[model samples]
Target: MVIMTATEPATAGTAQTETGTEIETASDAGTAPGPGPGTGSAPGAPAGPVRPVEALLLVDLQSAFVAGGEAVPDAARVLDRSRALLARARAAGALVVHLQNDGAPGTVDEPHTPGWRLHLPVAPGPRETVVRKTGDDGFDGTPLGALLTDAGVEALTLCGVLSEMCVSATARTALARDFRVVLPHDAHATYDVPAAPGIGESVPAALASRAAEWALGDDVEIVARAAEVTFTAARPGCGTGSRAGSRTER
Candidate 1:
């Protein structure tokens, strides 16, 4: 059952405040230093002329969702990728927005619980903005749209959990709002539980991947890897920037 809801504007200045800390503050813990634009090796795959991305949208990377219970395959891997993206966005002077899903009573993401908080391994800069969401869709009953608009974000690079649900749903909504949607394949993760335990026919990753592919369609541009994206200042009268070629894997 799909749930459709009206989109609300995100709170003004929802971006977080910088803690006056340097990028290397937590670099010792397996967090790789992300290369700056024009510094890193280009993605081997050919892509459209690279345009600057104004903002990075981190969808629901909460601890409750990515931990040991109900864990998605390669969740840790995606978290690492996300941390890299966060560093890159900060270095590029782009806005980073983190979304958190607050689960209802008795669910894994219950409020005030450790699981419901943003996961630790993935560190968001103190200045980055974070929004709390109660529903599956981040845009519903939340100020994500407004926040993006306020930040003048023309393109959105999305990564997070539950590809088929919140991630996919928010991507569709972003496209409908005329925002350029870029889905980094390896940047997001999800878990699929079979109806029956021993059925031996469950392929959650494939299903989630397909759902993301289908929902995005032409409205969204699928990026093979985060390293391939280039962010720049938005040019006037350009009606947002352009993205190269179709989606390819890293």
Candidate 2:
């Protein structure tokens, strides 16, 4: 993938791979400090371009979801993709939010517990917003919606743990709230689940992810990978900013 540097051309020519990572560099982005995951200029969103109201929402990437503990199946895969998404989002300077489950006290997700903390791989920066919740829907009774509104985000890119649960709930709520929602196929995941007495002992993680993807339906557009996703940096009144992007979207 070709990264955009401070003095480099940031128009159409630059690009990333299907890995879903964005550009990164301290020289670009004016003053975001050192280079982070996707911390660089945007190709589709050139400097002085009209910005779009979009953001990336990462949900339930808690330590509890990692391997061991209260683990989610295929968690390593989910983490890898999520990290890629996060780097790209940051590189694009897109609004990003990290939602974590504040499980009931004494549970694995209980607040401040070792297992309740965000997994290290998905850690947020000082400027990124972290929204804590006890419910599946990230927007339910949380500051999530308000934060998105404040950031002028009209579209939300969803990724994170337990694709069948929190990811599903948040996508539905985001749609209900009228924000365009995108679920990158490889970006979200869930564990193998126990089946009913008639079914069996376990349901494949891939199967669960597919079910959630289907349940999200047409309302939530699905992309095959993270690199194809992009955020708008410029909106009509938001000044000539850039927006996010995706390979799947027109």
The TM-scores, one per candidate, come to 0.70, 0.69
Give stretches of model 2 more than 4 Å off. 1-53, 121-127, 199-201, 234-250
Error of 2 at 110 (Å): 0.7
- Per-residue lDDT tens digits for candidate 1, residues 164-233, read 8888888888776777777666778787646666676666675656565555554566555666565654
Residue 88's C-alpha lDDT in candidate 2? 70
lDDT of 2 by residue, 1-250 (tens): 1111222230111111123222220110011112222425343332232123368888887777875756776777778877877777777777777776778889987766666766634333433566667688887867676566666666768888788899999989877666677776677888788778977878788888877776764556555555456675323233111222321322
The whole-model C-alpha lDDT of candidate 2 against the native structure comes to: 0.61
* Alpha carbon lDDT of each predicted model: 0.61, 0.61
